[model samples]
Target: MLDSFSFFNIIEQFIIGYFLTINTVYLALVVGALIYVRKQMLHPSVVKADALFKTELFKSISILVPAYNEADNIVESVESLLKLEYPEYHIIVVNDGSTDDTLQRLIEHFNLTETDIYFEEQIEHEQIRTIYRSPDTAMLTVIDKKNGGKADALNAGINIADTDLVCSIDADSILEQNVLKKLIQTFIEHKNTIAAGGVVRVINGCEIENREIDKIHVPKNFWARLQSAEYIRAFLFGRVGWDYFKSLLIVSGAFGIFDRQAVIKVGGYLTNTVGEDIELIVRLHSYHLRNNEDYQIRFLPEPICWTEVPTDYKSLRNQRNRWHRGLADSLWRHKYMLFNPSYKHIGMFVMPFFLIFELLGPIVNILSYIYLIVVISLPTYFNLTFILLFLAVSIIYGMVLSLIAILAEEIVFKTYDDFKDIAILSLFSFLENLGYRQIHAWWQFKGLIDFFKGKKSWGKMVRKGFKE
Candidate 1:
C-alpha cells in the first residue's frame, strides 16, 4: 500500500514515539525521586541513631537470611549482620538443605546449639530438620530444613520470627551499619506502612575489612561495571519514581523490611514462584486494597545494602533471565488487578506500565532492532536521517538516563568517593547502550519464552565471593 521510505517512516515514527514516551517517563521518575529524596532528607522525622533508640518508634525486628550453599560468604555475612546498629533485632538464618558445610560453619563459628524453641506455622513450608541458636550471641537462630526454594526458606524463618517486623536479605549481602535504623524509621513515622525496600549497591569493587565493606568504588570486572550502572539507574529512578506516586510495585527481595503479621495474612511468600519478592509485594497490595485496608509499600532511598552481583557473562545472563521471568510470572499471577478501577492507581497506571513498558519492552525493542537491520540492508532505504533519529532516541537517550542516575547517586549519598570510579561508571553508562542493551533485551525476550515454556529452574548461580 505504500513505498519503502513511507512504510519505514511510519515505523520510525512509532519507534521514536515509544522511546520518547518511555524515556520521558524515566525522566519524570528521576525528577520525582529527586523531589521525594530532598523532602525526606529535610523531613523532621530524620532522627539520629542515639535519639532513635529512646523513641517510642523503636520496633524489634527479625533479620531473615535464606542461604543455599553460600559457604564462601556465609561466615562473613553473618559477622557483618552482628555489627548492625539496631537496638534489638535477632538474626534468623535458614540453611535450605545446603550440601556444603554452610550449617557446620555457623555451628563452629557461632557455637550454635540445637534449641527447642516453638513457633506457630502460619504458612505452609517443608519440614524443618532442626533449629539452632547461639548462646553466646543470643540473637542468632539457624533453621535446617529440606531443600525448598528461597520462598519456602523465608516462610520458615517467618514462622520463627516473633518480632513485629521482619527484614529479608540475601545471605551474601552486607547491610550498612545503620540500615535498620533508616528502614525502621518508615514504619515509625507512618503506622500504615506495610513494607519498605532499601537501595542495594554492587559490592564487587568494595574493600572488605573484618566482614564489613570498608571502601566503595565502581566494580572492576567488565560485566560487574555495566551492572553497577544498571543498578544505579534502577534504584535511583525506577523504584524511587514509583514511590513518588505511592504506586510502587516491586520492593527488591535483596533488602526489604515487611510487617510480620501482614506477610502472614498474605500467606507469606509463594513457594512456587522464583519471583517470590515481587509476588509477595503484589499480593500485599491486592490483599490490602481489596479489603479496603489502608496500607503503604515504600521504597526508601537512604538505607544501603551492598550486595554481590553476577560478574561473568553466563552468570549475568542467568540472573537477568530469571529476573524477566519473575516479572512475567508476577504479572500473570495477579492479572486480576490489571485496569480494574477497584484497585485505584496501582491497577490503573502501575500494572499497565509494567505490562506494556517492562514486561513486553524487550519484545518491542528487539522488533525495532530487526526492522532497523532490514531497512539498512536494503540499498534503496539507506537514509542517514532515519538511522540517526533511531540511535538518538534509543541509544543516546539511555546513556543520558544512566549518567543522570550516577549523578543523582552522588548528589544524594555520595556513595562513591573516587572521582576516577565515577568517571569509569560514566564511561560504562555510555558504552552499555551501544551493544549491551540490545543483548540484554534479547536475554529478557528469551526469559519471556522460557516463562511460556514453563521453565521453573533457577539455573546455576556461581558466585566468586566478594573481592578484597
Candidate 2:
C-alpha cells in the first residue's frame, strides 16, 4: 500500500487538476467579457439606453405568476405588479388551488368578476375552476385551478397569455420598475434572441417601504448575510462570465422572459421536473439545435427581482436541496445534449461543466475534505503546496468573484448606501468560503443521494410573507 504522503499527493493532484481545468475555462470567459463590456460601456446598446424605457417600440409581455398557498403574498404581489412602469403589459395570476385563502384574497382584492374570455389550452394541466377578471383593472386576470405544481400552473397561465412574450415570476418576487423595459429592449436589439434572464437580489433584511426595496442592507444573521454575498458572486461574476462565453445553461425561475412562440413550439413547461425554468431553457436550446435554427438565450446584468432569502438554517437547506435536485433533474433529462457537437458551445462546454462541477462537484468536495483531514492528522503526509493551491483556486477565486460583483453593483445600480454594509459584505465574502460553501456542497450531495434513493420531497419554505 502507498504511504500516507503518496495517498495525499494523489488526492491533491486530482483536486488541483479539476480545479485548474475549470478555472482556465472560466478565466478565458471572464477575459472575453472584460473586452466585450469595455466595448458595450463605450457604445451603449438599446439594453443600456435609459431613453428606451420611454419608447413605444418595446414589446408587450404577459406576466405569468404561479402561486400555491400564497394567500399572504398574493395581494401585495398583485399590488406591486400594478405599480410596474411598463407601457403595456398584462398579469396572469394562476392560483394552484391553495388550501389557504389565496383564491379568496385575490378575488376580493381585485374585485374580480367572471368573464367569458377565450383561452387556447395548448398544454394539458389540472382542471381550471374558474377565470375571473376586473373590468377596472384591464391588466389583471386570475385563473383558479386544481392543485398543480408550479410548472402546471405556468402552463395554465401560458394558454391564456395573449401577448408575444411570457415573463415567469414567483409570487414572492418583486420586479424593479425598469426591469421589463430593459429586458424588452434587448429582445428588440437582438432579433434572434429567444429568451432573456435578469438578475435576482435578496430581499431579506432589506429596508422596504411601499413594497419596494429602497436600500439593500446586509442581514444581521450570519446565514442571511452569507447569502447576500453568495448571490452577488453567483450572478455578477460567475453568471456574467458564463454569459460571455455564450454558454449560460440556466435562466433563473425568479424572473425570466421567453418568446411565446418559441416556448409553445418546444411544448411548453415540463411539470415532471422541479426545475421547470432550467428544463424549459434546455428544451428551447435543444429544439433550436435539432432544427439547425440560429437563436440566442441572453442575460441582463440588472437586478430585476427582489426575493426574500431564508433567514433560518432549515429553510436555507430545503431551498438548496430543491435547487440541487432541480439541477440534477435538468441535467439528467437533457443528458442527450451532453457533449453533442450539434449544440456547439452549450454542448461542448456548458453541459459538460455542469455535469462535472455543478452536479457532481459536491461529492468530489466532500471526498477532498476527508482526504485533507487525513493528511493534516498525519504530519508526514501533508503537502503544503496542495493545501495552498486549493486555498488560492477555490477560496481566493471566490473572493475575486465577490469583488467583481461589488464593482458591478456600484457601476450599474447602487443599492447599498451604508459603508458598514459594504465592509460587512467584504468580510462575509471571505468568511463564506470557510463554512457556507461547504453547506451548499453538502446540500447538493444530499440532493444527489436523494435522487438515487428515489425519494421525492418538495421544499416548503415558511415565508416571512410579502411586504406591501
Off by over 4 Å in 2: 1-7, 29-40, 43-55
Over all chains combined, what TM-score does candidate 2 have? 0.94
For model 1 the local lDDT of residue 401 reads 87
Question: Clashes in each model (backbone N, CA, C under 3 Å)?
Answer: 0, 0
Query: In candidate 1, what are the lDDT values of residues 1-468, reduced to their tens digit?
Result: 898668778888998899889888998998899899888778633365457678655899999999999999999999999999888999999999999999999999999999898889999899999999888999999999999989999999999999999999999899999888888887887899999998889999899988888888888799999999988999978899989989899999899999999999999999888799999999999999999998999998888898999888998899899999999999999999999999989899899999998999999999999988987898877867878888988999888988988887887778888899999999998988988999999999999999999998898888887655
Per TM-score, the best of the predicted structures is: 1
For model 2, residues 179-203, the per-residue Cα lDDT tens digits are 7876777787788888988778887
Clashing pairs in 2: none
Output the TM-score of candidate 1.
0.97
* Cα shift from native, residue 334, model 1 (Å): 0.9
Model 1 alpha-carbon drift over 4 Å, by segment: 1-6, 44-50
